[model samples]
Target: MSEALNRNYRLCEEIGRGRFGVVYRCYSLATGDSFAVKSVDKSLIADDSVDRQCLYNEAKVMQLISPNPNVVQIYDVYEDDSHLHIVIELCNNSDLFHQIANQVFSEAEAAAVLAPLMAAIAHCHRRGVAHRDVKPDNILFDEWGRLKLADFGSAECFREGEMMSGVVGTPYYVAPEVVAGREYSEKVDVWSAGVILYIMLAGIPPFYGDTAAEIFEAVLRANLRFPSRIFHSVSPAVKDLLRRMLCKDVSRRFSAEQVLRHPWMTTT
Candidate 1:
């Protein structure tokens, strides 16, 4: 595979790095198009079999949701003796995390961001996919500020009676069920998205602490509150919507499709 790598992609420069791999900006010589190449070093991967299977699973999940305009496209997957390479659509702008870290978003900006994110999540649910990891870092934007959901490495397809036990996802965004090690479903993504929305409007996570345990405790026990100074113009209707979406009871939580039609999301 190493010998054939030069024939496939011409690596440019390092673009990003994550727990699993280093992403590189590359060019496809065959089509003259640019792509983000994620290379997972085999030596760095702790459990070879599980990591390889997860990589293949991620590729499969990407293919399942490829038709979605708000989901990043996975172009190719390959592996060499040294590493596994995944070629993905190159997004020009940075991720939502960077944007939020810079400052609070205006109501119009928040609405614009939420629209595509909701559509992407709805599409995933329609396809029976649950993106277990739905954090600001995974929501990327293009130059036009159009949002695209990225990183399906922690995603899973749920079937009837299927139950997931192990906790997965970023600590601040994880659902209570995940923290409890209880059987959980797709609604967990909705909760994480609600957390993201809260951050967009209030400029901070609803729950936060110095330690993971404290964060989990905050998530389970605290009520939602928005800083008036930061979100002075945000309406009660919007707050109500966030509360519903972030409901501890998964059954009572609003689905992505339902959330898209909520009044706060629809009004001018």
Candidate 2:
């Protein structure tokens, strides 16, 4: 493990852990700056080429999108015998998931958060990248309350006239097209974003079931119920925006650019 700790970074403490890897709070030995280091298990890399490609693709995407403030920056990627380490900006605040689990956000707070989130997604779309996974857990906040879209392990680049088919993303946030096992484009990401927005306003996902099959059925059927009590204070324009974004028809779903122009998103 000592050899895994490169000369430039000193691993401090574990900050997060998941199926892919463990994230550690590390400091740069050169500048003494703090950053989060995500170390992927080398065993996984050797076991699957697709998984390795995913990590490489994520690193490439992060490099391309790092200039945007709403996207997390990947400062470095390195590998030792046992692990692949990725160093990124350290965000002190919790993710949006924890915040929503506590309670739905107020209109102003929701707008503030969604603004940057949409902007980041728009950036990705413009670059031909589809962040197939967009959920509350993947949205992070910094110390100053600025929102950033994180986690690109499931993202892929698509060209015009091209389509991807597969079941991907969290069940509650996946688009109907993906669940139906049909080809889909970036609009699937818009659907997931809509789900995230709905949860932010209502404190829970619109669809829920005991099993994956039931959840997929609900998504395919567009069975979404808005809780008036929780979102009564939300404006009609906002609700309309959510409706458009959550549309089951991929062609009808609001694009990220269109989402930014919705009446509810206007500064006035």
Task: Go through the candidates in order and give the C-alpha RMSD of each one to the true structure.
Answer: 1.9, 1.8
Superposed model 1: Cα runs more than 4 Å off:
47-50, 227-232
Give per-residue CA lDDT, model 1, range 144-250, as digits (tens).
66789999988988775577766788889998888888889888888999998889888788999899999998887746777778767888888888988889878
- What number of clashing residue pairs does each candidate have, in the order they appear? 0, 0
- Looking at model 1, the pairs that clash are none
Clashes of 2: 0
lDDT of 2 by residue, 1-268 (tens): 5364677899998999988789999999999999999898867665667778887788888887777899888898887777778899998688988888998777778888888899999998888889999998999988887888999998988886789876779999999888888899988878888888888888777887789888888888996667778777778877898899999877788999999998888862
| Cα-based TM-score, every candidate | 0.93, 0.93
